[model samples]
Target: MAKNTVQFQQGFSLQEFISQYGSEGQCHQALFQWRWPDGFKCPKCGHVRYCSLKSRKLLQCNRRRSQISVTAGTIFDSTKLPLTTWFLAIYLVTQSKVSVSALSMKRTLGVSYNTALLMKHKIQQVIKERDDSKPIASYIIQLDGAYWGGKKRDGRRGRGTTGKLPFVAAVSTDDQGHPIEMRFSQVRAFSKDAIIEWATQHLCIGDEVVSDGLNCFNGLDEAGFDHRVIITGGGPESVKMAEFKWVNTIIGNVKRSLHGTFHAISKKHFSRYLAGFCYRFNRRFDLRQLLPRFSFVDLRTPPIPQRILKVAELCG
Candidate 1:
């Protein structure tokens, strides 16, 4: 990594984003490059040769009579919104420290509330799917938890009971001892199995895991994890590990970003939102280009009936 923070800072402005990718066709081309870096291939026939329908922006397959659009088989498939709006939404969400709300995004992008909500959810899902494929394999992993969403009124913490949920996060340290890799999962119960499952999925075994004195981590020895518990009650000497500081800094950043930006987060969809937060936080350095480079691939297709049922279930 070349440590280019300029892109992240410059692209944070909405005016700059509109100036760069204002046209739907330009946004489509950028997505096309992201989907097929080498070239386009027919999803149906697996043939690379295709005629470009310049008028409709579609590719006519040479082997088959069918025509395919660049947005086919992606999240944008069948979407009525302009590609430029989607690009701007992705850029804005990824660049912001706190994830933007659908309401705010609707106002910002001049789209309907429902459209903004769907766009936010779809982009967040894409980021989650992409990041989930690349798990954090190595490095000093620091684990901690934080409770979000508390109201403050008249100089009090407001009973600290705003129905906020608890989230467990892990951050990896770089060679220079700075935090780099990050992962977060919403937790209902802080049990041993829950912690171990999350750790095994996102991290490799034998990686040095540091946490505070929590009984849930006591079983890591049996789970084949190199785990250590730091008793903060033992004064500064016990908390001497720099890795712990890095983890604390990550947690603090998440809290500040969430509190300052979104204001409040619902508990029902907390995990998905947490995943989006972690995605943005991890890529905070190169979000400008990376954010625009994301495309919705058909990695996993939800059955329409099942998706509808799940939505109904959640609504109920």
Candidate 2:
């Protein structure tokens, strides 16, 4: 079988994307390929051969009794919306730098707000699941914290802030000054325990870790990590690791995207939004493949609409 090939350019419009893989069948076929690269098999009977029921888009197990739809046992399971809408939502989320509002999604896809929110949450769950599986290690990682809040009041920054939350981020840097992996979280405090736990969970022991002077990260040496601290007081002269600058840039971009696009973010679901942002940030350079792969999930379902709209309203 020939490999599925997709080409995308920078500033590519959504209409072009829809034209490429616009149908539910096309999206389903890609999901089938991603789910089972080898071929279709019956999950129940462990049989390699199964008959495809084109009418229901299901694979019937010839050896045994139950019928399974293409979405069984995956994130797409139990969804009532069309697979094409999900695929489109995924594509939009991956392509956009900031979180896309469910209201916009509803208008774009012609679906109810509830359905859009549900689909967004489901996609976020899938992304979180995938991130949990792939741990970031064996690279130079930069650690930092940034605060996100609602719109600025009276042209003041970092003050008069309400509904703000703290986020800790770890970004793995490549030799070419590009980020290879990114992990983020919403936490109550940047305490020693919190920082250590976040580091241990996302990074391996041997990798080098760099951070700006934060007392919470003082004893990283005891944890088997080559930790370096850069003092922020002395401007660029106090900088020890240049990589932190890139990491800071990443954080700045994230904050700017959130503030400009969403306006305000709630603490309750900050991690989900962070995960979505991290996923997009790490894959920003690979929009061609990522966008197409993203376009393969179902987003018109009800759950996603609620989650997305609620988050958007909270942010606004």
Candidate 3:
């Protein structure tokens, strides 16, 4: 009967984004502030005083005379794009609920597909790195194993499907059983060793983990966490069970978002996409602050080289 606060909330709009980071100079100033919150400290010498050379957009450290731009060493390093454009890209990526694809980003930003893909991957790399550093430690955790990719026609099915990727979906909830954060991690397989390794890295000890009756989940017990299994047997009835309600709902939402946003996803680069989704979902509580917070993290994240960015690696 009551209004849903998160659904009805006022989110950050393009108008507000323009008002704040509308110009190149505005974006530069914002990046400077976000990068050096305690005032300008030289990255090389740690000098507190610096002279801003507005003509060339560099700062000279008073101590060592070392020069640096606010964008230097950060994800925006050596980028030819205007800071305003970069900020807009960040805004679009953070503000969307279903996530943005590189092709859609190309159309929106009026850039080539390759350039847009580069920008998207760079931003997602920063997000993936940031989220990977923080592990889920919520009191009540719900976890489920899932697979991505369409069915193969070779008669192979379910977990053994040739083209499918195995992944674990975990939702951390509050005392009232509402999801507060989530982690989507790709795994080698649903074997005991794999589950133990993933759980050891992603989940904290002493937290209770709720899951269905999958034998692989016994690894959670071996990992020394409090594990509770609800045997919701397969089919529609199982998915409808209350014990797995939020986890099932989240998984469904994830599938929908993937189907609606992306046409196809490569297996190697899939982890970053999952990490990007988790990053957005975990930070969904404050839509207004999402841009600034994401930008702040972006400024702190080191620039990932194009060579490194092109390679696929595992990330949660």
- Per-residue lDDT of 176-283 in model 2, one digit per residue for the tens? 766677887775666677777666667788888888777777756666789987676644444344767666777767777766666445566677788898777666
Per-structure clash totals for the candidates: 0, 19, 0
Give RMSD (Å) of candidate 3 vs. truth: 2.6
* Cα displacement (Å) at residue 56, model 2: 2.9
Q: Go through the candidates in order and give each one's C-alpha lDDT.
A: 0.69, 0.68, 0.84
- Alpha-carbon RMSD, candidate 1: 4.7
Q: Sort the candidates on lDDT, descending order.
A: 3, 1, 2
lDDT of 3 by residue, 36-122 (tens): 888888878777998988898999998888889888877788888888878888888888887888888888888877777778888
Q: What is the TM-score of each candidate against the true structure?
A: 0.81, 0.81, 0.94
Where does candidate 1 clash, by residue pair?
none
Predicted structure 2, TM vs. truth: 0.81
What's model 1's overall lDDT?
0.69
* CA shift of 304, model 1, Å: 9.5
Q: How far out, in Å, is residue 91 in model 1? A: 1.0
Tens digits of lDDT, candidate 1, 14-100: 677777688977787777777667897777888988888989878899998579887766776777888887777887677776778
